[model samples]
Target: MVSKTDDKKAAPAAAAATAKPEEKKKVVSTIEEDDEFEDFPSADKEVIGWDAVEAAEKELNAWKDSWEDDDNETDFAVLLAAEKKKVSSAMKM
Candidate 1:
């Protein structure tokens, strides 16, 4: 029974009636303090031994050789980075 102009006017009013007013959230203040512990100093001061470094270098060289052997496949370093991401995500969960 309503004309097109009436329908158009009613549409906006209907929309406005159904529209929800946005809620204003309160600003909350929180204090975040970092506590220092004895273990932290120990962690910061810990020294890496030369023997450990040598062992790590040997293991790294072995891994490099194995990766170089697969020249036809995806790069070895890229695979290592992808594996690292997977491990990091798993730890987060």
Candidate 2:
């Protein structure tokens, strides 16, 4: 037979079973809590390879001038279409 003290101890366990379970705290994501922002370097520093870049720029300008001279003589739309067809045919091979 169960003792009176054992019955009293058992009463709390039954009461605990009948009580509603505690709700868990909801977790918030860092992305939701903080504003989206990115820190990028400011373009204030003087570039080191300015001379080489300037030389390359001069070369590119001369090339572009020559290309423009050639383009003035040709029908650019026809040239582009022909080049595109050639490229597509080459890709197929």
Return the top candidate by lDDT: 2
Error of 1 at 68 (Å): 14
lDDT of 1 by residue, 33-71 (tens): 222221222221234346556545644343443534644
Worst 10 residues of 1 by lDDT: 21-30
Worst 10 residues of 2 by lDDT: 20-29
Clashing pairs in 2: none
Off by over 4 Å in 2: 1-74
**RMSD, one per candidate, in order:** 29.6, 27.3
Summarize candidate 2's per-residue lDDT along 24-52 as a digit string, tens digits: 11112444434534322222123333664
Q: Rate the local accuracy (lDDT) of all candidates.
A: 0.46, 0.48
